[model samples]
Target: MNRLFVMMAVLLAGMSAYAQSEKRIYTKAERKSAEERKFQKRMETVMDSINYADAVKALEELDFVLEADRLVFKRGETAFVTSNTNFISLSDDNAVVQIAPFNGGGPNGVGGITVEGRASNIKMKTDKKGNITFSMSVMGAGISATVDLSLPKGTNRASVTVNPNLNSNRITLGGYLLPKERSSVFKGTSF
Candidate 1:
């Protein structure tokens, strides 16, 4: 019985020593690197909460154009615009603008019909902080759309809000706007 007790005590001691030795000890440099990584992660989180107006100010300071050749949506199809004229054309069936003229007399008016050509007006405005507001009116189709964008400095990503004067639905589309150089890459390709 005495010998058995001695063996048990020795075994327990050995196990305790083994467990203590298993603990990892980091070097000073390794500890510093870990701390730096944690600090960087925190900084990124704080940066994401920055105000949009401030971000637009930074873009303005950099003299950046908020308009892109292509406006890519997160859920819907992408829209491509001409660089010089901003003329956009989609397929015949899925065209954004549709026009029809009414000729018959209604409760309000006359039998004469007025026809207007397919003319569109575009107005673009930018604030001092580089935030952009674009409005398009298709007089022939009686369609009006306005887009407000908040752009960050040195980044292609933007927060966009689109309001169409059809019914009363406003859509929030958050996505990246491809730069001029990257726009060419997607020009011929179907995304």
Candidate 2:
């Protein structure tokens, strides 16, 4: 009778240990799954906020304005551009302003005859006129083109002057691009 009692006690102790180990394993898996679910929710919410059509429209209008001066644009062609992205977010008042450069390939099929011009001496500043001046000198194909864009509230004016080198081919650009909408895509959750 004494031997039976001792054996039963040992069995009960082993069962308790097994039960605790199983509970720990399940708790860890549940925690991991909950985290995964939270991440998925944030991702879906972000994907829904992008409006590509609005971005394309904005670029088209800006292009039309640039075109009035006879400057032609080609996708992956005529001119590649880089800009400092200034984001205005209402959620984070103290967020640091991000400066990002935009890279573009000018017209894809290049005839060495159609070398794309590069912008240098680029400057942008606001004046007392509540207007901003965007100025740059473009040089390529043995030619130089200088452009100054004066953007006033509700009005933007550009002064473009070109000097073509001897044997230089005239270049024109045409395209619809949505470079300004890059910020609309959310790559990850921001705190």
Candidate 3:
């Protein structure tokens, strides 16, 4: 009787071990699905790395365009604007800031004012975790403003604040900062 009981215990243990091992074996469809998922994950990682590098290069070179998806005012008011017509671009020391929100027409024949200025007192900083902060004073034909831009780690999305030197009202732009080649912004006539 003891021998039979010992044999039964050994059999049960073997069955359980087999069951666990069997769970790891994938069917043909399951294996293919897993492979595809792994491939997608790898591609996403590679793409993210490339985008992060591009953003870093754009910022360091001071040649980038910021397409504002939303315009935020100091009073907490927000307005959605067309990216192509409303953008802030900085290339070398030249900065062009435009805000055009019209389906028909407004200012500059597009919607709003397009101010082209010279960026000065430029300051750029990068943190250990790969975040960047940039600030400069822009003085031009119609506006004198200080622009502060922040870019988070591993992404091209940015928030930039434009504070005019002589006004209490400030505008913040939330958008993506991209190299000029990747940017799809349209320039309106400068005011």
Candidate 4:
């Protein structure tokens, strides 16, 4: 009986030791990769703070690009598009609105129409909570439209609704607002 008890104790101790040894141990490369990811995340947080401030400044100056990666129509159809081909840009007294419903080749060489016009009736308002309402009428040779933009507080994301004077199809562009210098959007031919 004493021998059986001793054998059981020895077995339990050996099992416990084996279990501890099976713990996952990261290699040197994995440890370095984890530390690098942590550092990258911290850097992105700091950069986002600075970028947010710059976006606010650009909004005040009326010089920013709102790249519309998502397109929504009044008939309830929504599409996710590439930012390079679909964007609404405002610079001083001029506003350019482009919509490429499809990818690859078409009109404006980006599969859609690009309209640039002189912006008038520019009404920019900001409430106490930092929300913004910017509306303007864009009139050109053949384009007559009203562009209304809304930016919520504490974030650079924005939604712009474009209403054409002659059409019932309302289009809204949803995306982030970025400073002009930081904007990587490519502008196609405009009418």
**Which candidate achieves the best lDDT against the true structure?**
3
What is candidate 3's CA lDDT for residue 162?
94
Over the stretch 38-100, how does candidate 2's per-residue lDDT look in tens digits? 999887555433322333233223321232212323232334322122121111111111111
- On the 0 to 100 scale, the lDDT of residue 137 in model 4 is 94
Ranking by lDDT: 3, 4, 1, 2
After superposition on all C-alphas, the RMSD of every candidate to the true structure, in Å, is: 14.5, 19.8, 4.0, 6.6
Pairs that collide in candidate 1 are: none
The whole-model lDDT of each prediction reads 0.41, 0.36, 0.88, 0.86
lDDT per residue (tens digit) for residues 72-91 in model 3: 98999999988888889999
Specify the highest-TM-score model's number.
3
Q: Please estimate how well model 3 matches the true structure, expressed as its whole-model Cα lDDT.
A: 0.88
On TM-score, the stronger of 1 and 2 is: 1
Candidate 3: regions farther than 4 A off = 1-38
Candidate 4: pairs in clash: none
Tell me the deviation in Å of residue 4 in model 1.
67
lDDT of 1 by residue, 1-191 (tens): 99999999999999999888866899999999999999998887666545344444433332222223443443666565433222122221121221111233432122211222232344446677654654434333433455455555434456555456565454444444432222221111111
